[model samples]
Target: MAAGQPVVVLPENVKRYMGRDAQRMNILAGRIIAETVRSTLGPKGMDKMLVDDLGDIVVTNDGVTILKEMSVEHPAAKMLIEVAKTQEKEVGDGTTTAVVIAGELLRKAEELLDQNVHPTIVIKGYQLALEKVQEILKEIAVDVKADDKEMLKKIAMTSITGKGAEKAKEKLGDIIVEAVTAVVDENGKIDKDLIKVEKKEGTSVDETELIRGVVIDKERVNPQMPKKVENAKIALLNCPIEVKETETDAKISITDPSKMMEFIEQEEKMLKDMVDEIKASGANVVFCQKGIDDLAQHYLAKAGILAVRRVKKSDIEKLSKATGANIITNIKDLTAEDLGEAGLVSEEKVAGDAMIFVKECKHPKAVTILARGTTEHVVDEVARAIDDAIGVVACTIEDGKIVAGGGAAEIELAMRLRDYADTVSGREQLAVRGFADALEVIPRTLAENAGLDAIEMLVNLRAKHATEGNARYGLNVFSGEVEDMSENGVVEPLRVKTQAIQSATESSEMLLRIDDVIAAEKLSGKEAGGDMGGMGGMGGMGGMM
Candidate 1:
């Protein structure tokens, strides 16, 4: 480790074209990522067949998945990848939104910088505008009544279908509504958070069940342990129920008979005492935090108690509840108790589709997202979309409704944004107008993908926009409110509406203020010029892009 001078690896020059600072580089990189994948969100959105520098092809429309595949080396290009990841993590379905919004936002910010707007000023205005968007969200949120089951269906179906799931969209949407309605208390408010969403493949929606009590396939050391427990008094333990002691310190000693005898007596007594304590705690079924001990097991089973051993870490998390004998880890550290339910993982098969459904969980943490399609992969992709929709629903259920699957609502929103641009202030209104324009891509992409003529699709969408009269546009994930869509078959990425707003608002605020391109990348004859080095995760992300 000799250090005369610090290692000064130079940045690739591409960033210089954008700007020298960290912010400028981020803008450049973000633009690359967003523009690269912007057209991959809707049905009409272009599908990218990203082939890596090494000849591997990725084929899909999932933004995170695609970005995961794409290889990017330029520092500027990597910024967009971060934005895409941010979108996925935040909304579960807004990768394209981040790209489109970030791309355009960068372009706008670059212009502002050209016009002598300080990066600081652009950031300030964006912060203010962000608050305004919250107001927009509050106002845009729709209210439904007791008779709004159909309305809910409209939202669900639109969300499912928009993501291109066909076979199970309408059915699952209705099923979701039924599942949600099953647990709604007498109170007028429907806590969407209470319903859990688990994703599975192979089994059709028909074979799903909702259980009153939690059931698991548990086993003890001996096969003779009970397979079933009735009226089970369950104690959810967050520690190992097994009797085996884990390694704590490295040691070797066994010279004296007295020492050996003393150790044996202590361990036996401790095991017996632990078992007695567990049984006396009124727990017939002990869910361990870690593995269980053997002697502790013998006493519990002899006492007619059910002792489970070796639960996977994930299973432990799903079942643990705080503030109960629900044995949480003694250590202060623990996973968040989203609910006392696990996701649906099935090995059953029914026809072509694998059996899939959200299992027994009333907590908002437990949700079964049902998406559909003809093929397994297609269904898988749609299922992924449904999962993203779950998050979007989480964020918006309090104040939003679903639109149609074909980007109909997005187009409407875009139009409105343009119309209202004049009413907004300064360059910010122009940014909002741009947001409206960007939204139209959803429906337009859907129409294009469905094989409709571009101009004709636009006309039809415009006509529908006028007729629908500016109602909220989204999928009815819980109800069967979609029609003509399956036949026409338009799809969007998961959670298009809210995600778009979030990605756009964020990117605009972040990007529009960039002052200059201090550095930039220049691709040259096979190798990208400038020393941006290899982007860690962006390789082969072309499929979704």
Candidate 2:
């Protein structure tokens, strides 16, 4: 109330936007991110060619890959990207569907905002809708047993179908199913890390094959070693065969030339003794994680043993699982029980490079899928597709549940959610209906990407879901018509759909609740200069005083 009083000012370097301004900015950012990946939704979806600053180009229709490649700056947009990543990591598929749903949720929330509905109400409605959708998903999901190989194949086919892997979908599907089935333990636990994917560019994608054992991208340590070993008794070593140096610094004084010669002989004898212990353990093939000394290699070759040096730690672990072998770190402690058995281990030339394959393990808990393609990009894309296929198959085996794909699941959920929305009598009901509308974005985007009228497709899909058994009916991207996705072998793991909806809703709700954005001044050279100038002005004033 006082007149002509000094007023305090916020630092010029700090800026803040609140209320509608903040919400609008965030909504715009989320929508832009969704729009960026929208066109890459369905089988007919377009691919994005992302070129980084170094000019590394990544051309893909996979949502996670595209988002990962893009250098996003906006915080809201980054949140949407996280949604895709979580979907990708959780289910290994349905990333685009998740991101698009989140964007649509935000878009719908914006409409509610304009109608004077509070953000909390919108978030609550979204949460309620999410719970209902999850229940509907459980009801719609079909049970799949471990022995249901046909259904498993269909699941793999569905995952591989709409992407770069479509060209070789059937072959890749068979390989993926076989690979996953091979790695499933007796307790029904599937460790996907046991499955190794190796890509070699030269052959067609259809030439891709599954190896029943591990394949090391290396050759025998020495040329004199056997190129192929039958009935391989593999010894996995983590320690080096070479003589290790002392931990502390020390100098050895050579009294004469004869003493130096004796020192060299002693070192060679130690290396030979290490190799002798490996041979005594009855291991015909050696896979060492560390270096093998030159003397040790010579002794190994002399013993007619196949040896691979400097193997990766991951490969070594996979070999242990594949052959039921134990990795021994001490050479003197080697025993026959520590050796892994493979019917055959051979070093073969593949794509002009030498690689060793440990095959014919009786009951391998690990397997390999050697993916071959004509080009590097094709190989990379095929690898991604195979990864998705493996992921879905593994998830299905782990959870024992599957669902029909081709947007059928989305249509059914949308229809049921709308009916559920009617029972709730509040503004939250509107948000529930908004959630239903958001679910339709999947089929809509599918139809739109396939060059069909989205409105017409959604109408037909809704009508089909109205019937009791036609809930699995969805838009077939290939024919641009509604069909029974289950009968057509279009299926996915139940986890994929559940994760997509859950993550998308959660992300959208988080973004919707943000009411303000306060950005600190960036520490750029210009700002630093301005701060220095201000300090200099203060110094001049003090001198004048």
Cα TM-score per model: 0.65, 0.95
Across 345-385, the per-residue lDDT of candidate 1 in tens digits comes to 22224344332222333343323333334455555565565
**Best candidate, lDDT:** 2
Predict model 2's lDDT versus the native: 0.88
Cα RMSD to the true fold for all candidates = 8.4, 6.1
Off by over 4 Å in 2: 1-10, 527-545
What overall lDDT goes with each candidate model? 0.51, 0.88
Worst ten-residue run, lDDT, model 2? 536-545
lDDT per residue for candidate 2 within 1-545, as digits (tens), equals 69999775656665566898778877878887898899998778998888888988887888899999887766678889999999888778889989999999999999999999999999999999999999989998989898888889889988887778788988888899999999998889888889999999998998999999999999988999999999999999999999999999989999999999999999999998888899999999999999998889999999999999999999999999999999998999999999999999999888999999999999999999999988888888899889888889999999999888888998888888999999987899999999999889999998999899999999989988896556689889888889988888888899999999999999999988999876554456654433223212121211110
Q: Model 1 — TM-score against the truth?
A: 0.65
lDDT of 1 at 451: 54
Q: Please give the distance, in angstroms, between residue 462's alpha carbon in candidate 1 and its true position after superposition.
A: 3.8
Task: Give the CA lDDT, 0 to 100, for residue 342 in model 2.
Answer: 97
